[model samples]
Target: MLRKAFMRVFSAHPIETIAACTGLFMIVLGVALGTQHGWVWFWGQVSAVFGASLATLAVVWTVRMRTTETRVAANIDVLARQLETSISQIHKSVKSGRDEQLPPSVYLAQLEQCIDNLIGVSHELGEITGRPMPYDVIEMMTTRHTLQIEAHLAEGKPAPERRLVTETDSCPSCKQTVEFQIGNQPGDSAKPTCEHCGQRFHAHRSTSGSIFLRLPGASQFTRAVSVSCPVCASKIPANIDQAKQHSEARFCFSCGAKVSIDPVSHACTLISKQDKLAGRFDAAGVFHCEKCGEPASVLTSNINGTFGICRKDDALVVLPAAAAQGSPKTDAA
Candidate 1:
């Protein structure tokens, strides 16, 4: 009797075992049966009790449903409808002696968790690539979720083939490739940090990555060449990141001078009080200019020098050739 009782306790999960023990003990006592109860009946009682516990767990977890499952299920419903229609069309074609070919519905599922771990040198790829966790980490996460959906769908037999749909793509942080397989999660957003450069993957890329501006009622967008931020006194650049980190950037929403870029589309437009003037160009061929600046962006002069407009003070000044050997006015242009 003691041995049978011990076996019962050892065979099941802690909680399930406890419930089985209590319920079984009650059954034997209620029936006034002792150890002599037939083995078949005793085992049958235990199985019944275990089955009840399992049903309870199913309701609590509903572990079958997930985001991927919902989407796949919707697709399945649509496919079923299409299949029915196709079958009807095929029957008509067959009666008329046409080809019996039907369009393909490719169904493939990936299970990422099932992927094996790195064996030798590939495991060290993390440090070499400067990634805290290797690409496999994301691949694993995506696969785990994917496997859950695939397991449920596989029972449907020849799954109605269709292109898979997934949320998110390429990791913004690492710029690393995210490749997933059948029954694996696809893409996810990852934020990376560089300890050496203090650069944040999702943050400013150039201290001037993007910038924009808004006006009271302008349907057409325009760039603000150069303007002042009355509040901070810091110049906000037409480029957002540059203005965010550098003092040379200027932004003032008041009097409608602001620089911002559409976060989603990355389109930038500058809003300024007046046309900008002043310009410079580097060897790489990138142009730097203001409206007034835009025209003077390139140094186009005749006779070796010309008078350009005073930049901030709104005055014009002459660009003279090398100070006449003995000239007192000696300012480098």
Candidate 2:
């Protein structure tokens, strides 16, 4: 309480305090020189000493004011840099779509704290120097923060569960079961690859199961026609990535027929077939001739030496096993 009162008075009457101190010092000097000097000389000496003391006080006050200004300016610069860095980080998080690193609420809290500190420093600087600080960046960040908060609040509500649509189909080339997951979007199709033959295809069907068809061309073509081999009438798999390089004509394994496709109309036509391409199944072990589409027991090994047949056309075919050969390891998924 006493210190506050003293400070209040000191700030209020600084000139008066300096004048009193100078007057007291002048009087002491006059008394010391009274024996040698007359009253007129004493008065002259007192005036000179008082003027010197006032000059010294003026110099000291100027130095202290300059020092205070320097420190305040440095502090403001530091605060401005900190504010810039914080805003840059916020902009990066928004730009790169990496906001998941920090949740919206948590990031908002951090930005609010930084803005508060910046505003406080700006206010202090404005009051001390009587100059307005540039706060356009702060205002922009505050506006963005407000918009983000509103978006979060509006979208944060719970939503109803959507019915999941799934379709299961068999691959025409390998007869592998292919399951597709259709999302809630309208006209959306699922592209599933066959694990058995590595063939990829898109499955599009209505919820009512009324419209079901395999796209004739690649995925890029808006128009699709149902494709079947002219000889064996087997379905074929093709996609955009495959069509870009070249149109792949499918060879029917069931009938040993070479197929050709019309790129514009997506029509399938059997070009030719060699009888020698078909191989007869004589062995007991399962054999899969992709060219002949022969159904036999599953072959366990990929090495032809284990169990394989050479065609009359001198073509060696590597077949995948359809099932395990009564082995525990082969049966494990």
| Top-lDDT candidate index | 2
lDDT, candidate 2, residue 184? 45
Q: What is the total number of backbone clashes in candidate 2?
A: 3
Q: Write the per-residue lDDT of candidate 1 for residues 133-225, one digit (tens) a residue.
A: 443333433453344334334333333343433222233334333332121122232243434343333221110112111111211111222
Cα misplacement distance, residue 293 of candidate 1 (Å): 14
| Candidate 2 TM-score versus the reference | 0.29
Model 2 Cα lDDT, one tens digit per residue, 229-273 = 686677642221112222335444445466666655576777776
lDDT for model 2, please: 0.46
Query: What TM-score does candidate 1 get on C-alpha atoms?
Result: 0.17
Model 1 / residue 219 / CA error / Å: 36
Residue 309 in model 1: lDDT: 35
